[model samples]
Target: MNLIDKYITEVGKHLPRRNRADIEAEIRSTLEDMLEERKQSPSDDAAVIELLKEYGAPRKVAESYVGPRYLIGPRMYPLFEMVIRIVAAVLFGVMLLVFGLGLIGANLSGPEFLKTLGNSALSLLNGLIVAFGNIVLVFAILERVLPAKDFEKELEDWDPKELASEPEPDSEAIGGPGEQIVGTFFLILVLIVLNVYPEWLGVGFFDEGKWVIIAPLLSEAFFSYMPWINILIVLQIGFGIYLLRQGAWNMASRIANILLELASIALMVVMLLGPSLVDMTPEKLAGTPLADVADFFSKGANLLPWLVLGVVIIISTIEAAQGVYRLFKSSPRSPYPVIK
Candidate 1:
């Protein structure tokens, strides 16, 4: 009802809801104690204002309680910056691709070419802005929802000797927040594209004067493996989420990663050895301008599945091998040589 109540109310406005009451009470108590110690009249409005001024502004006082708040906090800022850089690069690449495709079979030094370039730049700028906004929103949500203890421990528990010690085979950095976030994002992109926009697998070409998409490029045999492939991908996504929460890798995660990689490799191997994954035939393109090269491309299409699956299998195998070796390999992190 008085000046002090008004002051404390202002301070409470800035404090978090969870701690507002306790903090307001503490501030009131401290003010009262100071007034008692001063041996002054509680009704002295002028003296109370002076005391409040000494304590600092309401926002400043609240800040003292909560520390600094951010849309993206210190711990996640590095990852946010990295994601921004990646998104910017991807957008630039997309712009270049669009511009390059437009330049194809067109006069390069014309007004139309300049117009096309301008349109591409505008599209790229819009894309960059949207991507940046979405990334900030996601990181802001994560900053609020994620627990702080794991990050706190990572900061608090430090040993300078770690730099000198031999790298522990189990001490994998896959659980680093930056990598986990990037990996999860990439996996989700792949999941959406394959499941929701499977037609994107088709090749794009210019026909007559317009861009055309030649779809139905993948065969039924490829769709048959989707269930299994989706399962492994979903499992890996779940595992990645767990690791991000943990903020450090452990024995279980190491083992789980190897198993997932092996499963992927096995599935890829089956796709490679079994029925053809591509469905584009010479007959399919007979009506198009590509008819002349259709036969050559048809043969290459048969080999395309092999090329794609083989590359995936090889990468998976290499990753799995690393995980397996690390799981079994143990070496002392000693600075001293064996005395025996």
Candidate 2:
């Protein structure tokens, strides 16, 4: 076949099966018309090559025929981007927390310290890659499976009357979509690490030229609350996703937030009264040079549980209070007509 024919075939290969033949025929006809206008000999290979070059690469030409192709379309692009940033931030935060814990717990020589840092860095990089891949894959699947018209309908359903009735100058602003997205993403990572990859939460040390890892800092009693925590995480994730799509918080979201916060507080209270939340057993500390330090931790483990429980209660109380205030601030005013 001649260059033009070969070019058309290549373009056709890149096109969707349903429209390939029709698009190929149209492109070929257009090329012929253009060649006729240029007075280029179709039989001349050089002239055909020059003409094809002006037309552009086969892939580009096919793309033009296909129109704008997106793995995640414009409607979902902002949400997709927000999700990616949140996941990345959460991953970074988790890595930093892990590294800090290791630094505090592990006793290492200069070279061993450097090696540990290097390994932590590599692990963080890999985790980020995997997180990004998963996020992209999810969005891509949503893009394909979700009907465009459904999103359009959602857009159409919006009512201007639902806008905040009055501005509260003294009221604290609720978290924006970005903040909620990041918070939700962070919670998800916590759930996954706590449940699936608890070993990653441990400290590592070099012992007699062999690397040794300690048991995870969290105890089995802490894990007993995982199912409850998972439920909270899932709820928060759903709320965050709703805020992301709506691009604002409303009464519904505020109420959901308050409920989740209360649930978290209850769980923390249960944990505090139940059992020790930290595991610094002698066996976990045996091979390490920091046995004395570990013994101190074990002795002080009771205090550690109380400290953690106090922190959780304080944070959850603050969050719940904020949610209530936000709900009150956003409530519909009598002067403004409520949207049905």
Candidate 3:
């Protein structure tokens, strides 16, 4: 083959299979035109080579365009962006609905509805933005670290690892009865201390008294703390004990997470429901002993939080119990004697 043809072949090898032929034809046609222009001058090999160099080597031209290939091209991503646009539109619609509902509720009922709705809308918007940002960040990192095309090729077929045996739960990993009791008590103590003086733990929203209310009952001497607080602590302790006895740390952690979620929900419910439960008629509510009125409203408002917390706690407990039952059921038991 001639030098020009050899150079053309080398350059064509570097181009993608889809565009290689078209690119090769274009290069060949251009080179032929250059040769035709120089033929009349009868140029030496060095002059011809210099002319070809001026046109740039095929590899250099190819390398300039050899960066990333996108699943969604930049042009398409910007002008035809589907996911983000759809998400934003949905969120806007949700905001409008929430605002409309808030207006209707407030006009029909009272001003407190407006306050609650506004707070909830702001929170929802903030949470959605934060969540969207995090998800985008995670996906961007994954794309950079592990290209989707390569990942797809690698995982196209399954491997034996897919069916590998899972290890049985070791008795040693789950401590003895005594150790469990001690560990559970320690966890309970930490949870309680964190609740009592939450700022001490450096967690966000700890200072928000909405986390745990300490309402003064009618008989203050009889109860130094709110009656519900005592009930919750007892329930939490019971939950902890159950976790320890079952040796289910996973379940315990989930229960803890659910408790935190319920706490936040309780705060929202209070802000929404507290004002309505009050005797807003002015005369009756104002004339009644302030202490008695405060006590009644506080007690009533307090009930919802506990009730919501109880429902969440119960649901979490049931889920955990089911998980534990499934795990134990799948585990193979050995033929051994237990000391009764």
TM-score of each: 0.55, 0.54, 0.32
Whole-model lDDT, model 2 = 0.77
Report the lDDT tens digits of candidate 1 across residue range 1-340. Answer: 9989999999999999998999999999999999989986668998898889999999999999999889999989998997888677657766776787777545577797998899899999999889999999999999989889988998889878776653333444554355566677768867997899887566556669775676467888999999998998899899888876665556777889898998888888888888888888999878777688988878887888888888888888998998888778774366678898
Question: What number of clashing residue pairs does each candidate have, in the order they appear?
Answer: 0, 0, 0
Lowest summed lDDT window (length 10), candidate 2:
165-174
Question: Model 1 Cα displacement at 193 (Å)?
Answer: 2.1
Clashing pairs in 1: none
Predicted candidate 3 versus true structure: per-residue lDDT over 201-259, tens digit per residue: 21112123333223222232212333544455566567656655455344344545366
For candidate 2, the per-residue lDDT at 319 reads 81
Question: How does each model score on lDDT?
Answer: 0.82, 0.77, 0.53
Give the TM-score ranking, best first.
1, 2, 3
- For model 1, how many clashes? 0
Looking at candidate 3, what is the lDDT of residue 133?
Answer: 82
